[model samples]
Target: MTDQDTLDAPRDGTKEARLVAALTGKGQTLKQLSALLTWQPHTVRAAMTRLRKRGYVIDRVAKTEKSAARFKLRGDRA
Candidate 1:
């Protein structure tokens, strides 16, 4: 299947699923994820931690001083 098709595969309709889908593409900042999920920044961070525990390698991409840090999924154990 196409990458977009893979990413768009049926999910369980959970916020976490949406979070992973977002991260599967270009890096996203905490604020962006928060706005996308309608969650607080801390909540998004916590979710990232949970994903880590679940074997997703999320990398923090440093940005210019004027920009917030961005995060992306490096890979998944699965």
Candidate 2:
């Protein structure tokens, strides 16, 4: 399937599915995702860790110590 199609596909009602949808495009920050998902920051980080374990490439762009890190799905999936 195409990347966009893959992103759009339903994920069996898992939180990861929602996270995938949220991060499909430009991605989001821990705070943004936490707010969007109604989850705590630690919960968001844990979810992201799980996503990585599932073979999803999540890229983190660090801006500054005080700024929240930006995350995006890496396009180069084998």
Candidate 3:
């Protein structure tokens, strides 16, 4: 698909898609993504791995020990 087509494609209702949507324009912590998706932290991490396998770039922002790291989609639209 064209780059724009890839960018504009609708989410297919998968957990990974939902994660991508959530991270489209903003970063969110693992806890926030888990809460938003009603998924466990490990599940969120697995979905992120799948997204990476599918060639989506994800950025992680490290925070303090007491805070969860933040994640966001990088260099692409939702």
lDDT score at residue 75, model 1, on the 0-100 scale: 51
RMSD of each: 5.9, 4.8, 3.9
Ranking by lDDT: 1, 3, 2
Give Cα distance to truth, residue 13, candidate 3, Å: 3.4
Clashes within 3 Å, all models in order: 0, 0, 0
Note the residue pairs that clash in candidate 1.
Answer: none
- Residue-wise lDDT of candidate 1 within 1-78, one digit each (tens)? 123333433357899989988887677899999999999999999999887766677889898889988898875222
Instruction: Provide the TM-score for each candidate, comma-separated.
Output: 0.77, 0.72, 0.74
**Candidate 3 C-alpha lDDT tens digits along 1-78:** 223236443369966568878877767998999999999999999988877766677889788878778898785543
lDDT per residue as tens, model 2, 1-78:
234444434467777788887786777888889998899999999988877666677888787878777887777332
Candidate 1: worst-modelled 10 consecutive residues by lDDT: 1-10
For candidate 3, give the lDDT: 0.76
Better of 2 and 3 by TM-score: 3
Report how far residue 56 has shifted in candidate 2, in Å: 0.5
- How far off is residue 40 in model 2, in Å? 0.4
Q: Which stretches of candidate 1 lie over 4 Å from their true place?
A: 1-11, 75-78
Q: Candidate 2: misplaced stretches above 4 Å?
A: 1-10, 64-67, 76-78
